[model samples]
Target: MIIPEKFNAFRIHQLEDKQIHSGFEQITLDDLTDGEVVIKVAYSDINYKDALAATGKGRILRTFPLVGGIDLSGIVVSSIDGRFKTGDKVLVCGAQLSELYDGGYTEYARVKADSVVPLPKGLSLRDAMALGTAGYTAALAIQRMEDNGQIPERGPILVTGATGGVGSFAINMLSNIGYEVVAFTGKTEQADYLTSLGASKLINRHNIEMGSKPLESMQWGGAIDNLGGETLAWLIRTTSIWGNIASIGLAGGIKFDSTVMPFILRGVSLLGINSVEMPLSVRQQAWKRLATDLKPTKLHFIAPTTITFSELPSAFDAYIDGNVTGRTVVEINENL
Candidate 1:
């Protein structure tokens, strides 16, 4: 648990050209914030937000010349609080780690003590990062659905953007709880992969043809929707009476045309899933569930790869290009 004099971090720099790009840089410990806890970070994962922030594809970062990683898991090297101590295994996700603060793409991370979650008993650091924010959001969605009285007996649930990290976790978690999952993705090549992750049925994103009807055939019992536009609108119209739809992303267009017919007639509910500011107690429960009941059986299939710390900059390109099918963790400080 020796703190390094200088650590290597994937630092994003803003140039005079008003463009931002990330690369490895050597920085001293004083350069990082001395929060309640300092962790010798071991694993970090790339998410769509990270890609957008790194590649200037979207407005992900509120500031520049900062380290960028939204999810990280590792061991605590030192703690100023009695709740945590040196040599403790811990993990963190969301909590604005990357957006407004120096983040996980570093040899070490110093974060607020309250933002860290004790790594669940049955989970490894690698597994924790594998789940990361995506899995957390999926769990949050299901918890919201269950609170709305959703159950396996209701009918099949639909997961849009099924090839991405959140969608993959949603399929696995919903199916693990005995709900039949209908996964929708544009990537037809991932048919076998999605099926292996417990998708009972697969639908091509392009094949979903819908009219402007306020109500379509009652289809889904409940749904975990990552895309927002037409797909969400369709789910609202087609979901069975009393069914819930948890909206998680805006990867598709943000707004959609919808009418009151579905809501007035079907009593459908739209739940917005936000993982960043989730209460700490809720995060603990979600992580515990993920380590037990919600643990994805096919995480090996969902997050099938790992990249070294040096490979992180290039990895963002794959995410930006939408070539990433499953989660990939960045291995940091493994050699240390």
Candidate 2:
């Protein structure tokens, strides 16, 4: 692969007045953050965090300017690292791209060798981006929960924010592994959609009355919580004895009032799932599972949208406005 002197990159910059301005610009290899591997980026995907960073909606970027996209899949253009070389297929997710480093929204991406995973068998570059961070996060959550002794025999798993990408993947992956999966979402109109993803039941979040008690009647055996305010507190109080609750998002709110009663009285475990900054081995293993048992049976259903790189700027608003579901992939170099 020939490295171009200048290539197109969607760069994010903060003006002196503190507003974010992002658009395509021709940049050189030296313009990107330092990394050992240079990739010919094939596909990138949109996440809520990407939307926030690009639009300055939520202050996701630590630096003034960077390329925006948390996940990517591509072929290596070059690597100083011994483990990777030119023409190697690889993917990167949750490695702080667009947060602390220039990310995947470009024709070329320079990334840390430790953050890259060789494209697993059975997943093409586009398929890898389709799964991206959302799928990886869901797999990490389930893996952690199961590590903490979660089992289908314990009881059905309740997935909160079930219509979102991570929640949707969690519901499907759990069901495919023999666990009874229940989806908790405010969008009851999408009942059929949730059910098709293997949700055995739907709990309308808007209709349910969460009691204001430290410990409510035990309902779920375990849960994967994407909302972190009142819903998390309720899940903590109502989870069955010895159940695990994997906390992944804070869309509801950052703070949640809760007591240690669930932990002490019921022996419940609250596991926090942080996909970023994981050990290289752990990150690789997650993608390995995503290629096999945890591979979503309804992958296309979960991430049905594919947009050209030119269409990337206009796409972030839907995610910011919360009008989008599943996932969307951005094709940067389709022929790669």
Candidate 3:
């Protein structure tokens, strides 16, 4: 494959006024961050972090003038690394793209070979992006929980932020594996959508009274919590003995007051899930499971929207506004 001298990239720059400006620009490979592998990016996806970086709603980029997409799936154009070769299918996620390096929001992405994972069998380039960081994070959380001894027989699992991509995938994957899943969501109106993804019950986060107690009644065997702060504190108190609560996001608030009674008395474990900077073997194992036992059965239902590259600029707002239901994959170069 012959590489283009200049390709389209959605670049983010911090101007002299300290304001963030992002838009499409034609650039050469030399303008990108240093990497051993060059990819003809086939697909990228919208995540809340991607929206924050693009819209300047949050401080996600650690450097100026970087391509803006956290996840990408595509075919390798060339590789100096012995582990990968030209024409190999691969995906990159949770490797600090857009934050510390040029990301996937371009026709071509030059990425560190260490950040790449060979596309697991049973998943296409598009399918990989459909899963993206959201699906990968969900699978990682489940793997950590199960490794800590989480099981269906312990109790039903509660999934907060149940309509979002990670929550939706977690619900579907857990339910498929025999755990009864309960969705805790503010959008109770989307009950049908939640149920379709295999949620056995719904807890309206709006009306529930989370009492101020060191520990509360044990309602859940385990939990996958996306909204942190009070919800996390509540989960910490109410989780049954030996249950693992995987804390993935902090959309609610950062600070939360908690007592150790839940930990000391009940042995409830709170596992922090950080997707970035993971070991290569750990990253590969997660993707392998995402293709097999942990694969989401309702993938299309959870991520049915695929927009062209031209439509990418208009899509981030919905995610920032908390209006997006599931995942949205961006097609950068489908011909690749």
Estimate, for each residue in 212-283, the C-alpha lDDT of model 1 and write its tens digit: 788899989988999999889989989998899999998888999899887889888999988988889998
Best by lDDT: 3
Predictions ranked by lDDT, top down?
Answer: 3, 2, 1
Better of 1 and 3 by TM-score: 3
Write the residue-wise lDDT of candidate 2 on 1-336 in tens digits. Answer: 789999999999999999999999999999999999999999999999999988888889999689989999999999999999899999999999999999999999999999999999989999999999999999999999999999999899999999998999999999999999999999998899999999999998989899888899998999999999999999999999999999999989999989999999999999999999699898999999999999999999999999999999999999988899889999999788
The C-alpha lDDT values of all candidates are 0.89, 0.94, 0.95
Q: Residue 264 of model 3: what lDDT?
A: 97
Cα lDDT of model 3 by residue, 38-149, tens digit: 9999999999999999999999999988999999999999999999999999999999999999999999999999999999999989889999999999999999999999
Cα error of candidate 3 at position 110, Å: 0.7
For all candidates, the clash counts are 0, 0, 0
Task: For each candidate, give its TM-score against the true structure.
Answer: 0.97, 0.99, 0.99
Clash list (residue pairs), candidate 1: none
Q: What is candidate 1's TM-score against the reference?
A: 0.97
